[model samples]
Target: MVKKYRNFKEVGDAVVIYSDNYINDIEGEKLEDLCASYMERGFTSIVIDFSETDLVNSIGVSILIGIIEKVRDCKARIAFSGLKRVNYDIFSIVGLTKHIEIFDTEEDAVNGRVPQEMVTS
Candidate 1:
């Protein structure tokens, strides 16, 4: 099933991408395209708010890896907020947490309030 997502919004220096209930194969490509567009537009900081999302499949994880590659190439920063425990574990197991920061709230991500130890170069 296709997952729903909101339009990307600018929040200070970061752009926020809000995903819906689930992220699977169908939603992966769309997310990849959206993130590519943002990168093309010179957006260096991004926050993906998963407050409404609880599940993600392998395809979704792959898409996120693509975004992380782009972010690293641009020497940019990307963070995730409001991730459920399971989703958080998935990200960690995939080693995404090493490349991107995770926050308890969208506000913390947008405000660059993440702990120094959690911040990646």
Candidate 2:
């Protein structure tokens, strides 16, 4: 099961997405759909939480990359939080972190405590 923790703040114009399993194929799709739904509702910012999720596959990685592209195309922004060391290393190797903003906490990610960038690949 995929669980989400979210906080929508008017001032920040952000939505935080918390997930315990960050990389299940079905869950990843659900998260993507959820983000798209929010984008349709005028949300311009996003934060993804992955501290509890320690596993990922190519499909999962692809989903995340897709999210980054979609948000960028819309001129919106996104941050990631609670990344486990293993997943973080994978993301780093892929250069996803270089482009996608990441925070150690949900608050920081959603509140603009981090700088935004583009995906390297």
Candidate 3:
């Protein structure tokens, strides 16, 4: 079974998924499935890049929660990068920040380094 989600690249032990411009239920589910598949294949680090993502609806956010849980259950690490400022603030306010680290660039996410200014306890 070959499934394709927007786009993705594997970096060493990490897999980076590039999200769609508009993340609705359909695209969100595709992202989830692709990430889950990679986890099943033994990817210990995952990064979902939102550089291209302009907006994500409520359903998309709900789906993201599921993906976050799945990553935890798989005992893998996950991060998000390239989020537009508004989207990043929305995610932070929605409490996704509690579960995942957000970065300004894919390189930072792949490197697993969140800028100090963005860090919050």
Candidate 4:
């Protein structure tokens, strides 16, 4: 069984996961597990919200890459939101932006990628 992360909310076919202040090895693993569990649960969209995240180390970046690949292989859409300027630049430099969407807010991320059929007026 996968260990679920508590700081997340479900919207239609999307799930918004809030990141901790720092995304190091442990936190990154937890985030990966959470995202994987959500994918298994059949969510079509997954957004990782970095509103509170202050930093992401190299280990975290490596794990994020794995998570991104898993999400893609599962045919799911993934997005990142609320990233700080530095984090944004880091992600861009690392080519993560090439694989996923980036949004300014959790709502924007969720609304932008959730399966259209799952949306309501």
Tell how far residue 10 is off in model 2, in angstroms.
8.3
* Model 2, span 84-109: residue lDDT tens: 88989989888897788888887777
Worst 10 residues of 2 by lDDT: 1-10
Better lDDT candidate (1, 2): 1
**Roughly what TM-score does model 2 have, to 2 decimal places?**
0.82
Model 4 lDDT per residue over 21-119, tens place: 999999999999999998999998888999999998888899988988888788788889999998988898898876577889988998884544323
* Candidate 3 residue lDDT tens string, 44-117: 88899999999988889999989988887776788999999878877877888766887889889888764453
* Residue 2, candidate 1: C-alpha displacement in angstroms: 28
| Model 3 misplacement above 4 A | 1-6, 113-121
What is the lDDT, from 0 to 100, of the residue 55 in candidate 4?
92
Give the C-alpha miss distance for residue 106 in model 4, angstroms: 0.7
Ordered from best to worst TM-score, the candidate numbers read: 4, 3, 1, 2
Q: Judged by TM-score, which candidate is best?
A: 4
lDDT of 2: 0.75
Lowest summed lDDT over 10 consecutive residues: which window, candidate 3? Answer: 112-121
lDDT of 2 at 119: 29
**Candidate 3, position 26, lDDT:** 97
